[model samples]
Target: MGDTRWLSAEEMRAWNAFLAASALLNRQLEQQLKDDSGLSHPQYEILVRLSAAPDGELRMTELANGLINSKSGLTYQVTQLEKAGLVRRRTCPTDVRGVYAVLTDAGRRRLEEAAPGHVAAVRAHLIDVLTPEQITAVADGLGEVTARLRALGR
Candidate 1:
């Protein structure tokens, strides 16, 4: 076994705070999205991503990667959205084995309706609470951590 290195008191405090804050923030965002649009945060994220893609469509694998979701989970979410008339699935012409999720007109409208409130909720709960410098620092720090985790295939 390797030498056991434990977090110092300050590190522990910071780590705990980060975990708590992340949980709380996600909960708040989820609630807000659900209340405003009957969509979970993950669902909203998928919609947002698809909406930005060319022709409002993306391959299933690409969608899963962008969301960092499992293939089965993405399939489930896409199915649900499909049932709601928010998205449709299409076979990739060039790759018969591939599938694409395309946002429907209804999905675009739903996102348009929900976006304002979502932005408001984000600003109220997060942006408005932090100074610009602190926001930048948080973004930079999280970006670094994300890059490191991605490198490790986490």
Candidate 2:
């Protein structure tokens, strides 16, 4: 068997930079959403996904997958959102054991209110700092990474 290799200096720098940028961007976005709309970033993501879904409803399992969350974790979040009047749960008509998370009107309104500030924060904090060439490079690099990760799940 071959011994494992570790990252080189350049690779380490790139990996660390990516992690820092991702964390900072998430924090900034989360803060903006909390300040402006009283919604956490994860909650905002759930609402966004539900709002985009057909009939603004998705099976709990499906929502969990879309959020990359464990079923139990997603259930807890959905329950919290339900308490906040942002979402509701319904039994699936076709499947007695299935539950659906339905985005409420309040959730839609909250997302609509939060979106502009979130986008502005993203643009100001990251996109505005990048050159067009850098933007293209980042898009290409991240696209490749996403593709590779998706392939691994097959």
Question: For every model shown, what is its TM-score relative to the native structure?
Answer: 0.95, 0.90
Best by lDDT: 1
- CA RMSD of each candidate after superposition: 1.2, 1.9
What does the lDDT come to for candidate 1?
0.94
Q: Residue-wise lDDT of candidate 1 within 1-154, one digit each (tens)? A: 3787889999899899899988999999999999999998888999999999999999999999889899999999999999999999999899999999999999999999999999999999899999999999999999999889889985
Lowest-lDDT window of 10 residues in candidate 1? 1-10
Per-candidate clash tally: 0, 0
Off by over 4 Å in 1: none
- What's the lDDT for all of these models? 0.94, 0.91
Residue 91 C-alpha lDDT in model 1: 100
Candidate 2 local distance difference test against the native:
0.91
lDDT of 2 by residue, 78-138 (tens): 9889999999999988899999999999989888998898889889999999999999999
